[model samples]
Target: MRISRLVILGGFLTALLPVALLAVGYTLKTRALMLDTTLEQNELFSKEAALYIDKVLVDHRNVLQFTAQALGADALDPAQASPVLARLRAAFPLFDRILVAPPSGVTAFAVPELADNGQRVAGANISDRAYFQTVLRTNTAYIDPDVLLGRTSGAPVTIIAAPVPGPNGGVSAVLVGTIDLDSLTQLIGRLHLGASGHAVAVTREGVTVAHPNARLVQQRFNFSGTPVWQYLRGADQGRIASYVDEENTTRFAAFATVPATGWKLWLSQQHADVDAEFYQLLASSSLWPLGALVVGILLSVLLARMIARPIETLHATARDIAAGDLDRRAPEEGPQELVSLAVAINAMAQTLQALVVKERGVRAQIESAVTEYGRFAERVADGDFSAQVMVDNAGDLERLGHALNAMSRSLGLLVSEIKLATAQLGSATAEILAATSQQAAATTEEAAAVRQMAASVHELRQAGESVSRRTQAVLDMAQKTEVVAETGLHSVEETIRSAEQGRQRLETLAERVMGFSERTHEIAEINAAVAELAEKSNLLAVNAGIEAAKAGEAGRGFAVVATEVKELAEQSKAATAQVRRIIADIQRSAQAAVIAAEQYAKASDAGVSTSRQSGTSISTLAARVTEASQAARQNLVAAEQQQAGIEQIALAVDNIEASSAQTVSATAQVEQSARSLHDLAQTLDDIIGRVSVRPGAERRVS
Candidate 1:
């Protein structure tokens, strides 16, 4: 069993045992006391009965004394005696008979019914009894012994006797008063004390005089022979005791002696009847302690249970707590101390539960933060800088996430810058390569132009040799023709004067044509410079395209602008080719015209030689012929003017050569500008690369 069960049981036993013992002790004591009380009540009732019988005897003695004195009086005559007997009988009804006896042997006895016959010599022998004899001899009143006797009426009687005085004063008549014993017997029968309790009257000699039982009255009682008689004689005047009678019935008896008549009055009661009442009292008292003991046991059990229940609950709760169930709680109830304990225990349980939950939550957060940080670190290690970590709940973990995100963004920007720089570098290199190719093409064209100039000089030498051969043959023929023409010289003199005017007009026309050729070469040089500038702009546009690609999405519009520039460069190249072709056609035409002018000059020289020979042959006619020869010289002069015009055209060709040299210098400057643009693009590429962006999988340049 548990400790609580033991305690409760112990408490119940402790409470019940003493109360049970007390009840038993009380029951025994009460029964004994009730028995004592009943015995005392029976003794008191017997004493009261004895006292009543004694009072009746004293009243009879007083009546007898008065009658005796009346009999002794001198005034007592026979006639007076008869009246006196009448009065004495009327006054003392307890008396059976009354008589007056004189010394003359006359008797005067009064009977209540026989009053008519007065004094008579009657043989009522009470005059010879001891009490009657004593009265006559002693001259005193006396009571007679109980005797059997016949009065003057022949009735037996027990009587009282007194001596009446004589006229001489010795003895008069013997007075005898006879008592009725039957009447006393009837009075004793009427006395009642209690149930089974009765009164008895006995003479001083132990003779039964009067008793409630009719058979016992007027009987002789042997005082020395019977137990009750012996007890009454030895016992005190008023004494009480319990005894078993001859019939074997237990009785409580009391005895009293009447002083006036020397009679004993005894009262007796049954002991069993008196003790019945005490038993009832004992029964009633017994129930009280029994009820008290039962109630005490019940209260002890209730109190014990109340204290133990909470302790048991606390024990169970403790066990559960030990087993790791923090949620269990004990109920708060019962006594002050118990309730307080329960409250404290429940508080402890709740606190433990809260602590467990808080610990779990903290642990979960720590693990989550560790896992998230690990993933972020993994991404960073792989060079995938685009991943970002998000922070929540604003703690150390959140701060760490923010830091990682910032690093990622910085790395992304760095990688972008590096790609831009690489692209710019590639564009610059392409520009430099294009510029070097154009320079090589220009050098090859210059070499071909120099070879063409050598071929033109060789052709001019061959034309000079053909002119010398023709001059010799013409000289011989001119001598023969000179003789024949001498006569016609005078008529030709008028024509020579007209030819000199034409020579001056032709010189003016040649100067104007040479000025137009110089102007055209200057215009060709301006157009060539413009073409080179357009080509340089196209190279700049290509560099811009590289920069736009490097800038990625941010430079898309700039790339479009670069494309338009490239188209403009192509249009400028076409216009430059057209200008170069026009310059070449002009050079070819000018060379052809120079060749025709040389041929015409040779023919005119031949004509002038022939005419001069003819003019030398005639003298008087020579004057008139001089006039004719002058006309011929005028025509030769006009031809010489045309040759001067051709010489002016060759000067214009030399000026065109000077303009071409200037155009070549301007093209070289344009090529230099394109190379500078390429170098600037390369610088931009370096700057963009140096500025870090987010790193990609590799550090490769585009």
Candidate 2:
């Protein structure tokens, strides 16, 4: 931009400053108003929510009072009170159970004969319960500090007890109804504020009674330590407060006390929720000013350009002159000052043009001399020492050409000398390069051989270690084998003796079984004899009975005795047959036992023979293992010796490698020096030979 445009823009900005300030001031004022508006809105919400919760509590309390009034004097009668309690429990769905407790601390009647937790409570004592004690003393409604959860299907519930007044104006009995906190939590949970914000209710003692999170309700969160709670502790009216919550989030909260239960209701919102409107307002207001500023800047630039138009013409002319158009002049036009400036610039241009004309002639002469000198120099630069300069008519230029001619002649002679030196230097460098290359090749081969030797040494060391480990392992095995072999020999001898003893025992067992077999055969023969005797007694009895019949009464007594003896004889004969069969089975078993005993004796003899062979084989193996172990130990000793020799050889090779490294380093330095000398000689020859001395003539020194 032009300077004039910048000045105009600056003035425009200065004029618009107050408007920008007013916009900023308005934004700040709106922000404050927004904050106050948010706080009032939060406070209003808190009051409304508190009233809602209070109304529910009042309605439930009214039901309890009405029930207590309806109970009359029959509240003490178990039979009458039971029906009344059941009716109340049915009528109020929120109550988990209802109970009528007398001043004596005994609950004579209950709705379902069970407490909220499913414990029998009709005859249970309610004197120790918090709700019962509170209602008994206060003669008013008692809200249970903690809601105990039911064991069966019901949600957690608190006892709301209202005392029944007696005719004497003293409390007679308390009517307790379990209020399910689920309804209260639903009430609070349904109250959603701005996105994710919500409300919570804590008891008079700061224990959380209702919350969105069941865990928090179960936790009975104590709100006394929180800033919002502390603020509400000192005031009955709902008010908004700013604080960080337990989750470390900045929040704007309003709190109010539940007048019926003394519980506090906190309605909270995140800070961002409250600031949303303020930022939206600021954004909407800020766009207009930004657009206006852009328009103002554009207008300023156009106006400034119109005012500075004449000055731009002179600027163009000055640029043309600087670009080598010295004849270009600014037109003397536009405003008076701009016209004067153009006139002055034109005058300067006219004088500069004349001077430029004179300078052109001088420049031409100088350029001609410089051109001829450059031609001679170019010839010399290309390694041609035959070109010379033509003297010019200009006085100083002619002298310069003479000097160039003399210098070219001198340089030609010098180039001849330098060329010969460079040729010798090149030959020396070639020889040095070849010698260094051959040495490097030899060094490389030696390094490779040394690396191989080192690798072999490493392998030998590893092999020696492996051999030592194996030999040690073999030696241990051989010693163990020898011990085992000696143990086996003793074991084999014991085995042989035991086998002989077992064979003798088996032979004795065979003889006993053979004797048992013979005994069974003899028993069979004895039973056969008894069978014949009994048959004879039976025949005698039968004949005696026939005689009795012939002799009438006299023979009858004798026949009877004979009949008895016959019967006993018959039984004895039958027993004898059974004993014979048993004897036959015993004989078969005895024969089988004898066969098994004989087989056992034969097996014992074979076992003894096998044990003897195993001992002999073990003894041979022990001897062979000892010999091998000895050989391995000798080889191990030799390998260790070889490893030491190889290590010494490796050390000698390392020395040779170090010497080769030093030789290579020295050769590299010599090669580099030779190369530098060769390059320097070539450069000097080129410098001298390339200068113009004379054309079509060659000069050589050697």
Candidate 3:
């Protein structure tokens, strides 16, 4: 926690932090690049594998198509077809069998003699087979969607069917070659993927065409619902995806479609395996940063010691100075900043030592001056004015000694003067006492007269206060009334505004209603036109019915239509009459409502006029009351001023009476003090004779 340690820590972090961060960033970036490269490589490999598989399938299809083409019209004849089929099967041992089926979809010939169940494949009905049906329909080469169990070998195989052309140019028979799927399984198994990596081929339907696990191939395992199938099914070209397999192991896989067979080829590697290899490379690259961190720690310790050495030296010097060793000075050395600090500390110590010495000299001077001053004070207390303070070279103390010597001389003269003044004061006091007694009697008589006048003024002051209170009450009432009148005026104005708004709204409503009535009348006119049309239509229908009756059986439909038209016309006329009656009723109601609104508007106008008059009258009353209040307030102010003047006079009279009483008592005291003063002056003169102002001097009072 010391600054040195903190600085060392800061330096260490500065050296190590960036290197550590670079190492971490490099590791993470390398891992991302490595993973990306791995995924790309897997995708490329999958595409290559898919192409290889497609080539293999194409080779088989080519042989089947060549045989079918060569057979021409002889494909239906076992004599010519059997030789070619046997040759094709022998040349490619990957095929389980070579068979030929006629257009009837029945297998007419087969290279293999017997099936795995001992049934003859030649006689078997091939009509129900999907590949035979496809060949018969499109007349093109087709590969089966899934691997099937071979009828001859009882092994998983896929069929490739090619059409045989008839003599007339239509497909006459199908040449089918069954290829064993084990060759594809072995081909993918031999792929040089890393440990825990393998290639797979699945049918478009998600059935396993070829897999490293032979059991899955034999069982025709379905991957239709698996994540691997979901990725493969949608991929038109090579792409990489990650998924967890049925074994719960996460894997990165690349999928590509085999163009020839529409099967998907997947090249996959386990995630854990890839990560392990990546981390091994990362660990090997991390040692440089580790070494850097160790070197940083060593350098930081060296730097900390360099920084702390000079500071420690300064610290020791300061400690000694605090313990009273003022002679010690800090050594000025090391960095410039430390050197400056040491110089400042040494200067502070020197200045403190000099101040201590100067303070001691001053203290000694003060002690000597105080001793001399104490002796002089004793001589003065004994009434000896002949001695003087003689201490020197003491600031303030020397000035004090001089002042004491002058005060002793002045005191000797002051005592003689005080004795003479005391006798004169006694004589003057007796005359002053007689004069003060006469003046006090006259002041007492004047105070009585002033007091009597104050009482009468006080009565008038009370009456003035009563009038002031009444005026203030009237003023307050007038202000309140004025406020109330203003409130009423505002209310009246608001009412008038509301009534005007109501009247305007009513006029708008009446205008709208009148417009509605005019619209209704227009509707009536339209209804009358409709009624006239209905009557004309009815007349035309009746005439048409009459003509139909004359025309006989051919006009029966026309007659029936005419009767229906006549009935519709009659009903329309009745409906128009009812609409006209409703419109008339609405018009009447609207007119009555308009009259009522007009009447209410007039009544509102009358009420508003009355409220306006009342507001005006109240305002006038408030103004008159305010004027009366103002006049009364003026009278009250004048009375209050007179009252204040009288009260001041009363206070002055009371003070005069108290002063006169004190003067009379003081005169009697002065008469007794005069006699005491004469005795005290004689005693002071006798005491002054005992003190030696000038060495054995004596005084005599005459």
Candidate 4:
């Protein structure tokens, strides 16, 4: 709460801020750099180790491939491949054994032959081995991940095989070489990564190929479940990672992969070991800022005391002066700025003492002058401007006495002028009131006229709308009539076509009737000829009968013949008479049919003529109706236009009515204002009459 504490606190903060910031920034940057360097060094070591391993594996693969190519088809034969296989085994000591297997996966030849279960290694059937099958199937080189123990040496070994091509471009045999994994383990173990650091190599399946612990390699230990494998799995070339190991110790690991064999390598170190130096540097760096803070606090307290002491002395002096002790003064002895403030405070106290003495003298003069001015103000308030003040001293009171006299004279003159102006104002306002009353009456009449006109225009618009509606109905009816007329014309056309077709058919019927008449006549002629033949035969038979009588019994036979012929003649004559009658009936019916057909043709012709005439009349009626509809439509359009014009007129009239109404209202307000002005003029005359002015300052009353 005190100035001394605030000063001390402010100074301390200013001095310590930079030191604290510098310490923190340096600690963070240093830690980051050291962490990066540690990780980078571990990663670099893994890469170098991986490259070394890759080179060893590649060299072995190349040698095996070269030997396989050199042996070619001969690799399938034990006698032919023995010498070359011996040289391959002697050159690469890392290989425990070198052998050649035929397509059947049986070993045909092997260097340094060893017996397996009392059978020579040469005759061993390895067809079932996955590595042998892989070589045979892929027809390329392969490195097996399964570790095998040497039969004789009892050491970890793995197989790397290359296919030997035959003369037919097929694999004649597989050239397999066994690698001593102990050698790989020793090579990785040589890396000098700290006390807790070690490197190991594993296959893609996490099967250990080389490890510092030889027992793990011999047992084919799998690291797939460990945190180290989590970082190594599927890692392409190299990376840095950290995790808690199986031993419960957090470790930083760098992973690298051998490109030649797909084997993963990692160099692991304890977390504490990697960051040991970084922590030590951070601890030592914090000490300097802590000591700087302590020194800042001490210096701030001493400096704050020097500044606060002078200000505290000036505070006490100012308090005494405020309490009416004008003699008190601040000391002018500390810093230059403090001394200046002290002198200003002391000068203010002296000025206060001088103003107090002068204030007493001025107070008495103001009181004496106020008493004299009061009497004059009282007379003015009572409507009497007849008296004035007369002070002795020629100061503010003397000026006040002269001002009162002037105001009294001026009030007399002003009252006289107001009386004269009030009378004229009353007359002018009366005239204005009369004129405003007349204008209000005229505006009221105009408003009523405009309203009536607007009603008339609105009625006209309604009538026009009615006409438009009726015209639309007429047009609809006309459209229906036109459709009917068109249908009637089409019917007339069909009737005329039917009439023409009927006439042609009637003519054909008449020709058929004539042909029937001619046929009947031919039948009559044939019957006549038949009748004549019958009559002649009857005559012949009768003559024959006469001659029969002359010849007795022979004549009887002739008479029988004649009688039979006579009977045939009578039947034939009867048939002839029936044929003539039927012919005559047919002729009469044909003539009747011909006459009926001619009558029907004439009737159809008349019916068709009547239909055409009716259609013509209907068409003419439709045209007249359409014309009437168009005229009605034109009238409707004209009426609609007139309606719109009337509507506009109605709107204009409405607006005029409103304007006239507003004019009347404004006129009434003006009339009221004029009356108020007249009444005010009379009130002014009375008010001015109450005040007494000097003699001879009078005006005529209205």
Say which candidate scores most in TM-score.
Answer: 4
Query: Of the pair 1 and 4, which is ahead by lDDT?
Result: 4
The numbered model that scores best in lDDT is 4
Report RMSD (Å) for each prediction in the order shown: 72.9, 11.8, 19.4, 15.4
Off by over 4 Å in 3: 1-8, 76-83, 115-119, 151-155, 238-241, 358-702
Candidate 1 positional error at 285, Å: 6.4
Tell me the deviation in Å of residue 552 in model 1.
99
Candidate 2: lDDT of 136? 76
How high a TM-score does candidate 2 get?
0.49
**Model 2 spans > 4 angstroms off:** 1-32, 41-253, 258-324, 330-359, 371-579, 632-702
Q: What is the lDDT of residue 662 in candidate 2?
A: 76
Rank the candidate models, highest lDDT first: 4, 3, 2, 1
Question: Per-residue lDDT for 1-702 in model 3, tens only?
Answer: 876898789878987889978977887888778777877888898888889878877888887888898998999788887888888888888777888888887688788868777778886667788888888889888878677776546788889899998888789889998877887788788876667988888888889988888888888888887866667666666555578775677888778888877888888888776778888987887787888888888888888899988888899999999999999999889999999999999999999999999999989866766676776777778878766655344567656766876798798788667767766765666666566566656656765666676667667667767766776777677667767877877887788788888888988888898898899889999999999999999999999999999999999999999999999999989989998899889989988988887887788778778877877786787677677667767766776676677667657755765665566566556655655665565666567656555652322111
- TM-score to native of every candidate shown: 0.37, 0.49, 0.50, 0.54
Model 4, 58-138: lDDT tens digits are 788888988899988788677888888887778878877888878886677687677333445777777877888998889
Pairs of residues clashing in candidate 3: none
Measured with C-alpha atoms, the lDDT of residue 23 in candidate 2 is 88
Error of 4 at 357 (Å): 3.0
With candidate 1 superimposed using the best TM-score fit, by how many Å does residue 60's alpha carbon deviate from the native?
Answer: 2.0
